[model samples]
Target: MTAGLLAPPTLIRTTRGRAVVLGLAAVTMAVEMASLVVGRSIHIGSQPLSASVLPGLVLLAALGAPSVGRAGDRDRLVPFWIAMAAGLLLGVALLSRTGDLADLLGLVVAAANEEIVYRFAVPVVLATALMVLRVPTRAARVAGYVAAGAWWVLLPGHQAQTDGAVAMVTYASFAVISTVVVARSRALIPMSIAHCVLNVITIAHLRGDITSGGRGALSACLLFLLVGTFAWPGDRPGRRAAATDDGDQDLVTDTVIDLRDGQRPSVHRGEDLTWVDEPSEDDQPEPVGAPGDRRSANHGPPRH
Candidate 1:
């Protein structure tokens, strides 16, 4: 309603791609939100249904949005490490409160659902709308990140009251960090895993698993950050990455999925059809009769 009513007539008529993207964005949001109810009956045998994955699956079936919230191999590790740091702060903030198993489960479900809402749906729709209104792609995306984080902090049933309003600033900071990572990677897995790990860490403290209490949990979180930061594979395969002088860290998403076309083109390096106009030296097949060719044709002795 906000988009259609207020959209400039000039833009509405002048721009067609924006309209298509906007329509796609709307459908993506609607499908994800509606699936929250319709997906209740979605079951996969004995294991509990991961409602978090349902919206993504529905997008796949209805819209053919294969890349939505899905990670690519080249997605960077700095953002992921940042996500874990944010989750660590969140777990530490929750230490003062009393929580049980039910709370732990509740946190997990909330993390999943809220990520879809704040990170997945909100960014998609908002960015498209902003773009339709003449905002540049990068600025609109930044605004979307801010909007998602704001809602994450302000939403009543979500992260707002998680700490009894004690660390509201911490919650706000966490929201910002979470949204930025999600937007940058265009994948929910990093934030999702970090958040779930945080849930377990919090519950472990509450359940006496961490014998030294918050201190032990803090140690665990720190240790995780250390190992994951050093061990994380941030670079694309067949590439080596060091922090460059120009800050060339691959921070943002590589491909954009348009629901109108529904073509999730594989943009993997060296894999996609459009990866090269002509094969590189490494990609060139060996010449059969060339001296240096590894698979040169066997000599015909009868020719002598």
Candidate 2:
């Protein structure tokens, strides 16, 4: 199957969607940076809402990302909660190693803002563009992250410290890991929040809340907790209720995925992971023979 078919529907499914989100991010980023040029010192971020966060928040709201945990989507919440836990743990663990920290809340907020723009927005838009160009899904995902990772290291002079050969390699490795996470989780919020935590801990240190040799202790306990979100309790990741097409044989497996943006009833096969839209009643074959006929016994072509 083509990557176009496997492509998960994101907020940027269409060019218009991409344009709107990327455009908004651009405007917001400009405004945020311009603040530093002027007299406002909000560049370091603030307690509740920072200038950096405004753009990300507005874009997220526009894209309906926060709706992932709504009543209809409760089953998809495991990944989100697990992400939060992993982020918190990672934050505390890094404190002992990191030195000369910035404002904890400010750093967290700034990182969260970066998560929205770098981790979520750029990848989604870039991946969508690549898919539209018929690029392979895996390549598209990897390429999509180049901008985010590069921006984190290249754009701001502050990130130059992490630009050594080793750091570059690590960042590249992380890009791959995060690409896989985005593919599997299919939800931006989890990845975004997780990224925010990852970015800040090195600078903020557990929200700058506590201190101890617990650093080693916390470091030892820095379990990723990402694998825990592979599927819901007793729920396989790829399994879906079979959709009998009345003329085809389907071999679905034991994996369940929660698609982004609440698109319902997409069928995923084993490792291929191809997504097929649910067949409408009109698409089903008409009944054969007469009533009481064995061939005609598909429940009369499945009522609407």
Q: lDDT of each structure?
A: 0.47, 0.46
- Which predicted model would earn the best TM-score? 2
Residue pairs clashing, model 1: none
lDDT of 1 by residue, 30-143 (tens): 654565456452333222333445454332222222223333333435655675666555554554364333444455555555665566556767765665565655676678
Q: Lowest summed lDDT over 10 consecutive residues: which window, candidate 1?
A: 246-255
How many residue pairs collide in each prediction? 0, 6
Candidate 2 Cα errors over 4 Å, as ranges: 1-41, 44-52, 66-102, 127-142, 155-158, 199-223, 230-304
Please state every model's RMSD to the true fold in angstroms.
15.8, 12.1
Model 2: lDDT to the true structure: 0.46
Give TM-scores for every candidate, taking all chains together and pairing residue i with residue i. Answer: 0.46, 0.48
Report the Cα lDDT for residue 136, model 2.
54
Model 1 segments beyond 4 Å from truth?
1-57, 60-110, 159-166, 206-304
lDDT string, candidate 2, 1-304, tens digits: 2122123234334444445555665666565456435535454423333365677677666555321211113554565476566766555455435542334455566655665666555655565566556565446555767766566545343346565788666566555555444444343455555555555444444455535354334322222443334323243223222112111011000011111222323334443333343445766444346544545454545344
